[model samples]
Target: MLEEDLLYVLALQRVKGIGDINAKKLISHCGSAKNVLKEKRQTLEKINGIGAFTIKHLFDSNNLIEAEKELEYIQKNNITTFYFEAENYPEKLKHCIDAPILIFKEGNFDLSNRPIISIVGTRKITSYGRYFCEKLISDIKQYNPIIVSGFAYGVDICAHKAALKNKLTTIGVLAHGFEEMYPKSHKKYVSEINKNGGFFTDFWHNDSLIRENFLKRNRIVAGISEATIIIESAEKGGSLVTADIANSYSRDVFAVPGRSSDNLSKGCNDLIKRNKAAILTSANDLIEMLNWDIETKKEHIIQKQLFVELDETEQLVYDFLVDEGKELLDIISLNCELPIYKTTTILFNLEMKGVVKPLPGKLFEAI
Candidate 1:
C-alpha cells in the first residue's frame, strides 16, 4: 500500500463504528479509503448499510491527525502493515469476512506456500497438555509448517518453543501492540521469536492491554492459518473461542482429546461432542486433515526396496494397499479402521519402507 493510501486507511481504522466489513464496503463503493473519507455524508449514506451512525465520525479531523502520528511511528520503527487487499496479506485470512482491514506486522517470516496451523489452549496447561503439544510439533516438524499462536503462558508459549526446538517458523499473534509486551515474562522470548518467526497484530502501537483484547486477538489466530488446534482447554476458555472462530471461517479445527475426568479437557471434549472440532490425537491427524502429507510427494527422492521391516500398524496399511491395488487415503483409513491421520502416518512409514507409494490425488498404491 502507498504511504498516502495507508494514511487514509489508518484514519478510517480509527473511526468509531467502522469495522473491517464496513470499511471494506465503504472502500469498495468509493474506490479507496481516501475517497470514502472525502465523500459527502449524503453520498456515503446512499450506499447500503451505511447508516447515519456509521459515517457520523467518518470525517473527523482528529482521525487524520492521529493517523499521521501513527504513520510517523510506523515509519520510525519500520513497522510493516498488511492491507487486506494486498498480495502480502495472508491468503486464508483475506477470505474471512471479518478480517482486519489493516494489520500491523513486526516479523521477518513469510506466510506464503506453507502449511500454517494455530495451536491454542488454556494458560493453565497440565503435564499431558504440555507433552502432547511438544510431541505434536516434533512429529509434524518434517512438514515444516509455520506454527501460529498467542504469545501467552502455557500452551501458547509451549507451541512456540516446540516449533523453535524443531527449527520451524512460529508466529505470535499479539493481543496488544508493539509499544509494549504483555505479561512482561514473555519479553525474554521476543528476540528469539523474531529470529525464528515474528509477531503480528492489528492493534496500534499505543493500544493498551485489556481482557477483551484477547478475544479480539483470537480471530487472527484462527483466520491466519489452515487449521486451529486446541491442545487443552477448560469447559470455558479463550481456546474454545478460537475454535469457534476457525469453524466460522470454515477452517479445519482439531482438539486434543483428554481424559474425561480432567478439568482442562472439558472444553475440548465439548468441541468434539458438539461436532465443532475434529478429535485430534497425534500429528498425523492434523497432517491428514490439512493435506500436509502431499508435500512429501513433491520432495520425494528416496526409493528403496522392500527390505525394511513393517510394524503391526504399518503392515496393516501395506496389506490393505496390496489387496486394493490403489486406494484413496480416506478409503485406506476406513478399511483399516484407523483414523485418517493415523492412516497417513502409516502410509508415510510404508512409503519409507519402499512397499508403498503415494499416487496423484491422495491415492496410494503398493509398490
Candidate 2:
C-alpha cells in the first residue's frame, strides 16, 4: 500500500503545469498537499504564479480522480516512490537548486552508501577516448565507487561496462521513466547494472523521453556524484551541461585532454583552457585531487614492493606517469631530462610491458 503522504505528494507531482518550485511553495503555505487540495481558489490565487486558471486546473475534481488513478498505476507496477523528506533520498541531491520533491525507484540498491562519480561525454567517442575511459575506470574500481551515467552511448556506456567488469556497482539515471528504457539497445546492459546496483528516475512511468527531461536529469547525475568527468565531448554536447552543473554545485570536474584537432576534444580543451576542469590523465590524478585515501594507502604498499625493480630512468618515468597521464616523449625528456631518441627507447620498453600506448602524433600516453 502507498503511504498516504507519498500518495498525496505523487498526486501533487501529477498536477498539470505544477513544477517543483511551485509545488514547494504550495506545500509550504498549505502545510501539505491534502491541505492544499481543500483550500479555495481565492487563497491559492494570492500565491504568485498560481492564477485563477492554474487554481481551477489544480482543484478540478477530474484532475484529482486522474491523479488517484495514476497513483494506482504506480502501485500496480510496484515502483517505489520517495519524497525529499524520506531518509533514503540522496542527501546530495536534496541540496540541488531544483531538487525533485519525489523520486520513483525501481531497483534494490542503497544509494546513500556509495561514492558516486558521474562519467559523461559524446555519443561518438574515439578509440583513444574509449581506452582512456576503460583503463581509468578499471584502476579506480578497486575503491568500489558507484559509477553513475546517463546510459547513453560512448563514454557513459564505457564507464558502466568497465565498472561491471571490475565488479563495482553502477547506476544509470534515465531521462524518462520506468515504463521503457530509451535507446532500447541499452536495455540489456541496463538490466545488468540494475542487478548490480539500480536505475533512478524522477518522472512518472508514462512520461515521454523529451529533451528537457534529459537536461533536468543531468542535475540529478551531478548532484548524486562527488565529482564529474568528461571523457570526450564536442563543443556543444550534453556532457558540458553536466560539467557546468557539477561546477555550480562545487563538485570537482575532470577532463581528459584529447588531440587538439579532434572535434570531440574541443569541449574538454575548452574546459581545461577556461580552468573550469582539472586535466585528468589517470585514475591516480582523480584520487589525489579528490583526496581519496584508499588508493593512496594502496599505492604506498605497492611502491614499497616495487622499490628495487625499476632502474633510475624507468623509475623517474614511472613516477611521472603514475598519478598523471603524459605523452611518451614528453615525460621521458621532461622528467628524466633525456633526449627524444632515448625517451622513445624507454617508451617502447614500457609499451611492450603493457604500461603505455603510442597516441596520435608521437605522443605516448601511459596506461
Candidate 3:
C-alpha cells in the first residue's frame, strides 16, 4: 500500500460514527480511502448503509491531522500496518465483515502453513485450567501451530508462556495501542514476544485501555484464526463472546469439558451442552476435527496423478501446491485467495482424486 493511501485509511478510521462495515462499503463504492473521503456528501449519502450522520463526520479536519501523527509514529517505530484489501492481510480475517480496515502489527513471526488457534478464558484461572492449557499447547508443539491469546492474566498468559516454553510462535492480541501496555507487569514479556512472535491491535497510538475495548478485541482473536479454544470461563465472560464470534464466522470452536459444578467449567460445559462448541478433552480431538494431523510419510514428495479433471478452485489450489512445494492449509487459502474452509474442502477433494495428499501439521503436497 502507498503511504498516501494508508494515510487516508487512517483518517477514515478516525471518522466518528463510521464503523468497519460502513467504512468497507464506502471504500468499495469509492475505489479507495482517499476517494471515499473526497467523495461529495450527496454521493456518499446515496451509498447503502452510509447514513447522513456518517457523511457529516467524513470531512473532519482533525481526522487527517491525527492520521498524519499516527502514520509518523508508525514509520518511526517500524510498526507494520495491514490493510484489509492487501494481499498480505490475513486471509481468514479478510472474510470477516467487521474486521478492521487497518490493523497495526508489531511482530516477526511467520504465519506460513501454521494453523492459528486462539486460546481464551477467565483471568482467574484454576490449577486445572492452567495445567490443561499448558499441556495442550505443548502437545501440539510438534505441529508448530501459532497460538493466539488476549495476553492477560491467568489462562491467556499461561497459553503464551506455554507456547514460548515449547519454542512455538505465539501472538498477543492487545486491546490497546503499542504506546501503553495493559496489565503493566506483562510488559516484561513484551520484548520476548516481539522477538518470537508479536502483538496485533487496531487501536491507534495512545488509545486508552477501557473496559469496552476487550469485547471489540475478542472479535479479532476469534476472527484472525481458523478456530478458538476456550479452556475455562464463568457462565458469562468475554471468552464465551469470542467463541460466539468464532462460530458466527463459521470457524471451529472447542471447549475443554469439565465437571458441571465448577465455576470456571460452567462456560465450557455450557458451550458443550448447548452444542456451541465441541468437547475438547484432548489435543487429538482438535487435531481430528480440524484434519490437522495425518499420517507422516518418510518423504514429502508423492507421485501425483496426471490427467485428473479438476474444477477451477481445485485446480487453483492444486497448482499452488505443485508450484509452492508443500504448503500449509491456511497458507494455500491465503495465496489462492480462497476462504479457509473452502480451501480445506478443495484439498480433501484433491486428496480423494489421488492428485494430492495430506501430511502431518495440515500440510498438503501434490501427489
Instruction: Provide the clashing-pair count of each candidate structure.
Output: 0, 1, 3
- Models, CA RMSD each: 8.5, 11.7, 7.2
Off by over 4 Å in 3: 296-367
Q: What pairs collide in candidate 1?
A: none
Give the TM-score comparing model 3 with the true structure, all chains together.
0.81
Question: Per-residue lDDT for 110-185 in model 3, tens only?
Answer: 7767899999999999999999999999888888899999999999999999999999899999999999998999
Which 10 residues in a row give candidate 3 its minimum summed lDDT?
A: 296-305
Q: Which residue pairs come into collision in candidate 2?
A: 328-364
Using all chains and alpha carbons, the TM-scores for the candidates as numbered come to 0.81, 0.76, 0.81
- Candidate 2 C-alpha lDDT tens digits along 63-102: 5666676688777887777677668788788777677888
- Candidate 2, overall lDDT? 0.78
Candidate 1 per-residue lDDT over residues 45-96, each given as its tens digit: 9899988988888988999999999999999999999999899999999999
Q: What is the lDDT of residue 164 in candidate 1?
A: 93
RMSD of 3: 7.2
Residue pairs in clash, model 3? 302-367, 303-367, 304-367
**Better-scoring candidate (TM-score), 2 or 3:** 3
